[model samples]
Target chain A: MIGVELRLMLRRRRVWLCWVLLCALPTLVAILLATTRLAPPPGRGGAFLSAVVSNGQIFPAAALALVIPIFLPITVAIVAGDTVAGEASAGTLRYLLVRPVGRVRLLWAKLISVAAFVLLAVLFVTLVSYVVGVLAFGFGPDASIGGAGAIPSLSGVELTPLDVVGRTAATVGYLALCMLALGAVGLFFSTLTDSPLAATLGVLAFVVASAALQPLDAAAAIEPYLPTSHWLAWIDLYRDPILWTNLREGVLVQLGYVVIAFGAAWANFSTKDVTT
Target chain B: MIVATSGLTKRFGRVTAVDGVSLQVQEGVRFGLLGPNGSGKTTLVRMLLGLVHATSGSIEVLGEPMPRRARTVLPRVGALVEGPAAWDHLSGRANLRLLDAAGPGRARHRRRRVDAVLEQVGLGGVDRRPVKAYSLGMRQRLGIAAALLREPELLLLDEPTNGLDPRGIQEMRALLTSLNEAGTTVVLSSHLLTEVEALCTHVGVMDRGRLALSSELGALRTPTGRVLVRSPEPDAVVGLLDGQVVDRRGDTLTVRGAEPAALNARLVSGGVRVTGLTEERRTLEQVVLELTGTGNDRVDRRPREAVVPGRSRGAGGPR
Candidate 1:
């Protein structure tokens, strides 16, 4: 049933287009990095691939990862958020509900498809980061420390190529978790509203409001607990000493967000009178 | 019973859309739900399908409590509620294929079924065209095809003849008749009384959220013995009968107050010549309209009840 739902989502032209464009962003940026010499440090043609592959900070892939939470999540929210609302608006939800399927099963199929899309979006960012990062910076080893020295990094650790891949894979895995949670937020909002636009905007509003609230000095005490504040915690994966303490907490917090969103979605969707 | 509802009511905010309406549909019967605009026919249908919540009363479909979980009943029923049912971006065939894929029906055989229904609905050659490009009539046909994809045991169609040309209406009428003949129970709601009279075996007339009348098509029709008598001696007939007259035209009069013996005896005794006396009676349209107040002014003011039938289709389908 989930596979069937996923097939339907993939068949949607708008959703497919959004997925493809986001997937190609990193690849496009990598190509540009390889052609241009404006890359800082480790100068010259040889450094091009090395710099490009490891260029998560300046390349389009990294830019997307950063910019996506601000914009893409809203788009992601729209896709995930409109999953149910869009059907209602199109007058298709009633048709679907009349099928020989339970509401729980139907909702599950939809959620799974949305989760798949969210993973694809995260994988899009991760793959671009890996491809361009390796091509521009060389697979020599990700030695650069990200932000504070919390998690371990390959830059100064002198690890093997495979080890670096393993570490990056783990890091990408955590990032996927955070992204999936955001997608769930969109799903929850989608279940609440009958209008596709309202569902899409509602999810974005929650994320944007959280982002806005994170920097408020007056509410600094509660800022750490905000869902948006922990989005960047994936960077902790590239630290020198590997601070597992805060990293584990970030994962838990992300999971907590997923639980709340999905819980709300299920409760409301189960009872929401599908007027359409 | 294929479908049954008792005191089914739905209220949106403060307005009672459907109020205390009870209805029943027997198996293999083409039941027509008739009513004027805002009479809550659509709302009742929606609640029966579990598509909308009923504010009060209980509805049982296929011998099971409705809306408790529609899964058991949904598989046995197919419906097309107002307008074309399709994704505008998809081809007509693709829309059929999608619906076909969702149910227990086999996807491999779906193509053949899709084609058959399209052909039946007069949309055979345009399956490749995007649904958005189809004309209103074509779209309506496509919607019917989509609804028929599963070949369910029961079909609920709301004004399936809207936008159909003369030939299309004839075809649709034939198609519905054939479906009923094949043991597929049909419940259709239409404003065209003539259409219902032509196809449906049973009908339930609604008046402002209430079931005003429900009976077999044959029973609701006018008696077979009445005669339509037109004469140029209206005043003379009125004076001669002394109260047996039903209606007086410009110079004509309809007399249903006497049997053949009494009518002929009185006419002979009065020395009045009868020019024409046709035995044909009223139409279901006349009966429905008169009963529903659409034909109140024109209705025969005698003791017999006015059988109103014709009402806007909006009162029955999705509002």
Candidate 2:
């Protein structure tokens, strides 16, 4: 069922359009940084921008940083939101339920498909950035930067080729999990309503809402638990000592959401009346 | 009984959609659930299929309790709920393929089975088109093909001809009848009396969330026409009759399950002078309306008012 759903989801022109949007962001960042060499203001994508200016190999890290706030989460929201609500609104959920698939099993298939979408979306952005970076800026030994280190020559150094590849994989894998947590949120909301647009917006709202809360001093105590809080923690992967504290917290938080969100989704969906 | 529900009720908030409907559909019979638009036919069907949870009461399908053992029973019983609902983005064949995958496992012949069902529903060559592009009739056919994909022993269809053209309706009737003859017990709900009259052997008519009547189609179709008599003493005349009177006016009444000679003799003996006597063979629609009280508003007036039917009365349909 998951395989079948994935195939169906992938066939949609909307899905392909989302993929294009995801891949385009990183490619744009690479193209702009490669041509202009103008430094992004100190706080933003500066570290990644500087890294890209120095070595093409570091562009994937830069791309992941640039898009974590909006583009990637939005793409995930659309796919995950459509998981169950789309089927219900289309009037096909009843047919699927009437088949041998149990509601629990069907829920699992939808979750898996959403998680798969997250994986594909995140990987596409990273790969596009890497390819464009290599072609334009030129590849070499990669740069290593600490968490919160998006500036050039400021707490940044070079790394071996193997380290660059390995770190890039870990960065993407970790970010994918964070996006999967968001996907689970969308899936849970999908089960709650028959409007796919509403579910997608709800998930997007979570990401935006959490990120917006980051500016509040009082909200800091509750900040670490938010899915957005640790998104940039992936930059730790490029550090020399490889800081795993924030990365570990990020993984655990994502996994925690993955479990709770899915458990909630199943609880609601398994016994849910197929009214749509 | 292949399908049975005892005191099955479902209430949507303040409205009781299905009020204690206990239905029994016999095996090897084409059963029709007749009702107006919001008569709870769809709700009852949903409960039977475990698509909607019953507020109370038990439902047994094919000798097994439902919404509990639904996983075990549903795969064996196919259904087209409400109307044709399919994945519009998918090709008809692709939609069936996915549904069949979720159905009983027949790994190798799955493609062949899909092909056969598409051909059976007359979607054969056109099934490869995206469902979005298919006409309503084609979508309905695809829905039927999906339901028939598993070779289910029992098929539950809700308003199957809702979106079909006349030709499509005929083809659907023929398809279902042939399938029923092939030993599939069919339980269908429809407002299309013509289709039900032509296809169903038994029926359960629903009105205002209640079963107004349930019996064999033969029992429902009484060859005897209703006895209408106009008399000055209407109360005295009604008091003289023993059988149920279908409709009543100031000096006129239509009596059912009655005899003209006996009624006339009874009225005359009772000294109730009558102005007119006639036997009107009521159509099935009139019988349904009278029995169901769907014509309650007009039926209330005691004069010769046009009992304009077809439009719903005080009680509104489901939103």
Candidate 3:
């Protein structure tokens, strides 16, 4: 079942379209930055955008920040929301159920497929931006500051290229987990309705509502628990001595959402009548 | 028995879709479940396939309880419910291969199994065109091919020939008959009486969510004990038969109280030229119409009663 779901996902032209669009946004940003050479002043614009003009190694982090706010979530919601509801609307849900694919197994396969999409999207954006970043602004001239070739962290500490690579890998893993939590929420909505559009809209509404409430002082008591609150915690990965506080809290919160949302999906889907 | 359901009922909120339908299908017989539209035939089939859970009742397929043992039982049973459905973006062959891979089958045999079913369903020359490009008849054949991929012991089809042309329908009937002959019990649900009449050995009629009648096709169509006679001299034949002539239309008379052979002899002996003489048996259409009520799709308002000035006033007003 997992193999079938993965093949179906990879075979779709829409999945590839999503990857292209995701990579396109950062590449477009790279072009403007390379031509203008005008990096936003510190504490303005997307995180790491002010730093990308000097160190190309930090471009992946900057690119991730560019898409994470809206583009990444929208694409994740589209794919995840279509998981069960798309099949239902197409009238193939009943056939799969009768094919003797257990409901639990089908949900698991869908979760894995959604996770794969998230990983692929995140990885493509990072790799494309990395190449674009290096070409637009060659490896930084600050190699003499620390050992051989080193880049400055968010702090004044100069870190080697190897350290930057390791931190970017950690950043990739963290962002994937955050998107997966959103994917689980989308999966739950997918099981609630037979219309894929409706399910996708529901997930968007959820993200929008959560993000809308995050900045309000009135919502401060429940701030840390919101699904979107921990999404930006990956920025701390660039600290000289990694800031584990928000990173650890972010991992725990995202894991909580994944468990709860997935549990709800399994509970609802296993008992659905599959009338379609 | 291939399938047995006792007190099977399903309710969708306020509407009862299937009500107390106890059905039995014998092994090795082509069972046709006949009903009008919205008479619960689709719901019953979905329940049997475990696509829709029953509100209350029990269903047994192939001697094992349904849904509970569905994983073990369903692989041996193939079905096409409501109509055919497939991923419109993929070719018929690709769709079959993917569905075949979804179950417990071995990977090496998937190609052979898919090809065999496609050939069986008359799509041997099919190309790589996606299902979205296939005509309705081609799509229906593809659906059947998917069902046949597992070589199941029992085949449950709902309106199997829905989108087929005349020749396609005939080919489907022949295919099902040959499958039954090879020890596969076939169960099909259809609203088309002619399709069932030509294909089924046993019949079950559904009316308003209830099983109205079930019996062998040959048994429900027993001789009606009336003989039809056609003679050139209608007046002489009617006069000769007298009280035995139940009905008359031109030169043809429906006569009772005599066998076809005896009636023919009497007509010939009476100096009447008998063109045709045959016993009248009940047709499947007649039996079905007699047993079932009007299809649920129809709605008729009751006639208002005329009110006298002195009678109760409420009864005459518009409802």
**What TM-score do all the candidates reach, one by one?**
0.82, 0.85, 0.95
User: What is chain B's TM-score across the candidates, in the order shown?
Assistant: 0.80, 0.75, 0.92
Q: Across residues B1-319, which tens digit of lDDT does each residue of candidate 2 receive?
A: 8998999989989989899888999999999888887888888899999989999999999999998998789988989997888778888988888888865576688889989999998888873668899888888888888889878999999988878888888898999999999999999999878888889999889987887788888777675667889988888777887557778987888888668888788789889898888876545676677767452224355454445578554457422
Whose lDDT is greatest here?
Answer: 3
lDDT of 3 by residue, B1-319 (tens): 8899999999999989899999999999999999888899999999999989999999999999997999999999999998999999999999999898888768987888899999999998899999999999999999999889789999999999999999999999999999999999999999999999999999999998999999999999888999989888999988888899999998888998898888888889999998888889999999999988888889765456455568675766555
Better of 1 and 2 by DockQ: 2
lDDT at position A247, candidate 1: 70
Candidate 1 Cα errors over 4 Å, as ranges: A24-36, A39-64, A128-155, B105-108, B223-226, B230-276, B279-282, B290-319
In candidate 1, how many Å is residue A215 off?
1.9
Please give, as one word, the docking class of candidate 3: medium
- Evaluate every candidate with DockQ and list the scores: 0.42, 0.58, 0.74
State the C-alpha lDDT per candidate. 0.72, 0.83, 0.92
DockQ of candidate 3 relative to the true structure: 0.74
Cα error, residue A5 of model 3, in Å, equals 0.3
Chain B TM-score in candidate 1, rounded to 2 decimals? 0.80
Q: Can you write out model 1's per-residue Cα lDDT over B1-319, one digit (the tens) per residue?
A: 8888898888889978788888889999999988776677777777878878888999988889989858778878878775555677778888777766766545676679888998888888884677778888888888788777767788988888999998899999899889889999999998778788888999998776778889998887765465555566667777888766777777666676556656766776898777776655667876677667442224464443333368444556433
* Candidate 2 per-residue C-alpha lDDT over A119-169 given as tens digits, one digit per residue, 9 for 90 to 100: 888888888888887777765443344222222322466566676778889
Candidate 2 TM-score to native: 0.85
Candidate 1 per-residue lDDT over residues A61-172, each given as its tens digit: 2544444566457557768877878877777777677755566777777778877877676666666666565556443334434321121242444334454455566666
